[model samples]
Target: MIVPPPLRFGVLGLGRAGVSMLPALRTHPHAVVAAAADLNPTARAQFTRDFEVPAYDSAEALCASPEVGVVYIATPHQFHAEHCLLAAANGKHIVVEKPLALTLADCDTIIDAVERAGVTLIVGHTASYNPTVGAARAIIRTGELGRLRLINFAAYTPFLYRPRRPEELDSASGGGILFNQTPHQVDASRLLGGGMLKSVRATAGVWDPGRRTEGACAALLQFDDGAAASLVYSGYDHFDSLEFRVSTEDERSLSLTSHGATRRALNEGARSPDEETAMLSAMGYGGPAMRSVGPGGMGMFQVELGLAIVSCERGDLRLVADGLIIYDDEGRRSLPLRYDRGVPGRGNVFDELRSAVVDGIRPIHDARWGKATLEACLAIQQSSKEDREVYLSHQVTVGD
Candidate 1:
């Protein structure tokens, strides 16, 4: 078998998310980080020092480089479409971070550019790549779930409390939890429900006056097929659902050990709770030196976070640290999954892109699918603002 040369990647943005993706891009079997772009001199210097790759102070320089075959855009939410267009214009394939764009119109603009350039585009909807998420989608398709009925997903994090660039605290700039975090939940819901979204009714809260973006959101979605989903998310730094689970002994042990120490330290006034959380949030930024135990004992890789539950007709599926948990009339069972540490979820985004470029296989979550998810997210905001249900066109489908 002949092994083709790795696809050379030009990374745009050096923020926390961009920096985090560097290690994976470098380690991917079919991808390599050939160049990077960021406006921050500190970031450029650090990236060059760490990766020994040419770092540019502007995205245009990186995109124009002959070494880059693919451009990975991890810029802030407001700039996604702009960066994508630049990359497409340069005749480069693209891998964009999720929430594809701030609005459906921007998504369409990006779609137009990529289609015109005849370049492959893939959105980094990492949750959709999770093996457990894939397993849930598979179970639903098997008809064992007997027609997907409801999905209940909830997440709470110290998002708002995290260190931020000014844009991150402004909703219009795509800084809030809705644009930043809810994409995962919305994509996961769409994947499991397997239908077009019909409507959404939601409520959002902005508890902190200084941070004007929404601190919490609750939404109810109705699918065309009669399936429904409810989402509850908070970024107010109050609680972490992943750390609060009680089903497994491992969770309990972690809670008693790691969490217990933090609580004790907080009570002792060694550091304020807010300070400790900010420190924790800072860890997610910076270059990618952090590593964690991967699934199925797959060694170490960057850590990702989220929690979700899919309630179908006959059973309930939950994503756990190791894999999945299903509860039904027959009780409960745990399913362990293998991890591909090179990329998010199952690490198939690069492979999918490669297939699209090399074998003409359209990606499962192509631009249309990403646009639909973005539409759903935008509808959530509209529903909250109008205090009424917002209807959707369901413009994108599974295979279109």
Candidate 2:
């Protein structure tokens, strides 16, 4: 068998998103890091040292790399669209991080740019990429569960208390759960509900006086097919929803070990943006050589971002750490999934991107799909502001 040369990937941003994917990109059969770009000199230098690839200080330099066939946009929320446009203009296919952009118009701009450039664009790294989510969606479509009725999804984390950039704690700058986290819930819910969010009623909580961005939200999403999802997310550090996760792995603890330190650091005092950026670079791809020597019974990648409980006419589906559990009149059973490794927990996203780039297949989670998810997220905020359910008009179905 003849194997094609790996698609050279240029990564823009050395912060959480870009750095987290580097390890996976290094190991993927069809992908490779050709270059990277970051505004932080520390990050660029670190990336160059670790990856042995040119790490540019500006997005333009990274995008201009002749070796790059694809560009992965992992910049801050506000920079997503700009970086995407740059990559598209450079004739590189794209795999941009979640929420696509800060606004629908920005998302549309990216869509138009990529369309004009004739390059594939995928906005992801979300729960929709979970194999268990895929399995659940397939099982629901089997008609054995009857009609889909309701979905209960919730996730709690120390997002608000984590070390953050200046834009991270400000709602006006797209720093909040509605932009960063809810995209996962909304997209996954849309996929499970068969897409098309008809309307939304929601309440977004912005309770932290120290950090003025939204810290929590509870949304009721109504799909076009009449399915509904009650989605809740809280970034406050006090309560952890993962504690309630059902898993195939050791079921003893669900604590985020780093949460305490990050929360303490946040509460200690204000931190300079440069200090935080340096800290972010240290945690990213090139900063420090890191290792974890833990007892290995279950795999490290066997985890989910949030929990979901789906209700149908005849049965229910509950997502677990390793796979899924079904409850029907016949009894209970589990379906554990095993997929190819990529991006830690997000194997499907990698697969989809590969197919788009190598086989010229359009991903179900393409630009329009990402826009639909963003539209729903925006509707949640709008609904909260107006104290009324906001209707949606731009939703599209999932899949080809």
Identify the leading candidate in terms of TM-score.
2
lDDT of 2: 0.80
Over 23-60, each residue of candidate 2 has an lDDT whose tens digit, in order, gives: 66776767888999888787787678878889998899
Best by lDDT: 2
TM-score of 1: 0.86
Look at candidate 2 and give me any clashing residue pairs: none
Considering summed lDDT, which 10 consecutive residues are worst modelled in model 2?
292-301
**Residue-by-residue lDDT tens digits, candidate 1, 1-400:** 8877888988898766675576667667888889899876766877788778899988899889999999988877788899999999999999999978888888889999999999999998456666677778888888886778888877776667655566776888887878877787788788777748899999989898867898789999899989998888887765666563445664555543332343344345424446543443343324343333223332211122245678887888877756678898899998767656464463566777888887798887878889988888889989999999999984466663
Q: All candidates' TM-scores?
A: 0.86, 0.92
**What value of lDDT does candidate 1 attain over all alpha carbons?**
0.75
Q: Each candidate: what lDDT?
A: 0.75, 0.80
Query: Could you tell me which residue pairs clash in candidate 1?
Result: none
Q: For all the candidates, what are their Cα RMSDs to the real structure?
A: 4.4, 2.8
